[model samples]
Every structure is written in C-alpha cells, then in structure tokens.
Target: MVFDIGIVSNKKILLVDDEEDIVNLLETVLRKEGFKNIIKAKNGIESIELCKREKPDLIVLDIMLPDIDGFLVCQEIRKFSTSPILFLSAKDEETDKILGLGIGGDDYVTKPFSPKEVAYRIKAYFRRHQIGSGKQTSYSIGNLSINEETGEVYKNRNHVILTAKEFQLLLMFCKNPNRILSKNLLYEAIWKEDYLSNENTVMVHIRHLREKIEDTPSKPKFIRTVRGLGYKLVTQENI
Candidate 1:
C-alpha cells in the first residue's frame, strides 16, 4: 500500500466533523500518509463553505453535525462538485449506510474505526482515480453514452449527473455489456474489499445508478435483474 508521496501531497482532502478528536486523529493519519493539503470543518455549514471555497479532491464527512446533517450537506455539495465523499458516522446501522450511499457517498466508515484503515481507504480511492485516468475512451449503448476520459455520462444527449461510485458502476457495466455481474463480483471490484454478505450495499448503489441511467427504474430497460443470478446491462446489440 505504498503511495507516491508527491502525488499524495498535492491532493487536497477535507475533513468535516464536529468531534475534535476524530478530526485530529484522521488528520494525523492522513498527514503521516503524506497528504499535506488537508482542510477541516466543524459543522455542515462550514463544510459546505469549505467545499466551495477550497474545492477539495475528497471529503471525509460525519453524519451528526451541529447544523444540517451530513446527508443534506452531501445533497447540496452534489449540486456543484462530484468529488468523492466518504461518510464517517457514529451510526453503524444498515439503513444509515444505505441512505448515505444512496444520497451520493462513495464510501462509509462507522465511528470507532481505525485511523489507519481510514487512511488506507483514502489512498485506495485516489489510486483508483489514478488508474482510471489516462484512458481516452468512450462507449455508447442505446441512448446512454459515457466518456471515460472526462467522466461524463449522457442519456439521449442530455447530460446526467452521477455520484462517483455510480459512475464507476455504470462504467463497469458498459465494459461488460450483456454479461451478468454478480453482487460479490461487483462489491469486490468497486469497494476493493472482500464480500461479506454485503448484497444490500451493492443493491443500493445499483438502484441509484439505475435511477440515473434507466428510463424507469421499476422496469429498467438497460440495467436489468437476472433473477437468481445477478444484473446485466443491455446494449443495442442485445436489444
């Protein structure tokens, strides 16, 4: 898990948490990992303001804030930036995790989490972005078109806004058109972690992705369920 210090030092990270100890711990770990440009916010308002002003590359957000919860903050931020957001919340409930991911979070880590693990997650995200870059490619299926180079998605020529994770999911599907993708395969591929009965996590992300790319999520025309198997993206050839 060695990262390029020069690259890591240049990437700005925003940490939003009212808890001083939590913020300090994350900052310490990130700094030790060679991330030099780090910003901190104590409330949702400050976080939003910092996000606009600083334009961070990634954000570590907390659910419980002084004013406006992290969910609302994420919604507001989504209006402007597609920067990856990782939720760091004390609530470990499945519902909270689903809501966080559905709203736009790229990852979620419950409180009492290891500082080192959080650092590693941040590095993993940056690494994925680096690997995904340098590819000047575009794919089109039906009315859906994706530009991998620009990370832009369009449906019937209308621009579509997608969360980071959602974009990755659709890109994966596009690369494997007409092929059924199992939940375990997707979870491991996108999350970069072993699957541990995290079907709901993959399901929620796919549902959100479908809402953006499908004409009707309830009766999806593109990304369809394979009943007992998995999900597949239907291309023009398949259609």
Candidate 2:
C-alpha cells in the first residue's frame, strides 16, 4: 500500500544503465509516477557527467556497465554528490547487494523487478524523508545539515558535494551522533539483503567522505574512528 499523497510533482531522478530497454522501461515507470525530471545515462562514465550537470535527486544504477563497472563509478560519484543510489543490477547475490549498500546505496532492486515494486520502494523512501507533521528527514550536527528526503547534505550553509555513498554514510553517522557505529552495522544498513560483499567497499567510501568534509581527515572532527568501536560523529571534542 503506497501513496504519493504529499509528494511534490516535479521530483527528479537519474536512471543509469547500459541496457536501453531497461532505461526506457524505468523512465516510463518514473514518468507515470509523476517524476517530471528523469535523466538517463547509458554507462558509468556518462553517469558521472550527468551527475555533474543535472544533480538528480535519486539514481538508478546498474552494477555492470560497458565502460566502467558500477561499483567503481559509485566510488567516483561519492567524490562529488550524495544523492540516494538504488542498485538496478541483475546480479542477485546477497554479497553483491550488501556490497552495493555498504558502499553508499540506500536500497537495492534486483533485475527483472516489478516497476510497481520499485515505485513502491521509492515512495517509501520519499515518505521517510518528508518533513511535515510526520517523520522528519533533516539532520544536523554542528554545521552539517542532512535532508533525508532528497538525500541532500550541506555544511555551514554550503552545499557539500558528496557522492551518493558518502551521503549515505554521513546520514547514518548524523542520525546516531555519538554512538559508535560498527563497520558491520554500516555495511548491513546500506546493503540490505546482500548479494555480494567485500570489506574494501566500505573502507573506500569512508576515506572519500573524510577527505571532502573533515577539517583534517587524518585527524577528523566530525566523523571519528573509535579505535576498536568503529566510527561516530560528534560536534564537540571528546572530553
């Protein structure tokens, strides 16, 4: 049971896939759902360019691409933007799915998936971010601002360009603030129902995010490694 009752009509989405049929079908489905701004990129390289130009609210990315693999593209995308990423790959392995999420994707939709199901999940994700007389998506720590609705993040009134995965990782930290989030916790939250996974996926994104937002990534102020505990976000110095 999904409803777009409070949703804005002009939402934007980026659909990235090498397969034309899949892109066309998903584009059609998104158009029918009231997303007026739907952009398309056939491969990972093109996807990066589209991201720089359009800055879509969400992205539908395939795991496999003709030029570059989806994971690598995801890593690179994490460098500049933090939009929500939903893997649209055909690989159905638990490890793969987990790996995608762990890297920066908010959700994973297997190939041959129902358009309606994808729509439903998208709706749910949107609802989760809507700030009204309901669940609020905006989060802040010190000068950082995170909008869960659009998956947009900012710091000190400045738009912090974070890759989709970096944004995801930031959101998890901001929500908990001082809680020491274990690597496993992070890995699982991003990649629900993993189809494949490797430890490097999470490590790479973490390093990238630190470089972008931290005053001294080597000596982080916002996101800190808790030695044996993992990572946490704190506004003030640990006393």
- Using all chains and alpha carbons, the TM-scores for the candidates as numbered come to 0.93, 0.65
**How well does model 2 score by local distance difference test?**
0.76
Task: Flag regions of model 1 displaced more than 4 Å.
Answer: 1-3, 237-239
List runs of model 2 lying over 4 Å from the truth: 1-8, 133-239
Q: Could you tell me how far off, in angstroms, the CA of residue 151 lies in candidate 2 after the best superposition?
A: 7.4
Candidate 1's C-alpha lDDT? Answer: 0.90
Residue 24 CA displacement from its true place in model 1, Å: 2.1
The TM-score obtained by model 1 is 0.93
Best by lDDT: 1
Error of 2 at 131 (Å): 3.7
lDDT of 1 by residue, 1-239 (tens): 45566878899999999999989999999999999999999999999999999999999999999999999999999988889999988888999998999889999998889999999999888877774336588998888889988889999999998988988899899899899999999999998889998899889989988888889889998898999889998885442
lDDT of 2 by residue, 32-148 (tens): 877777889988889999998888878888988999988888878877776788888888887787677666676778888998788766666666555555455688777777887
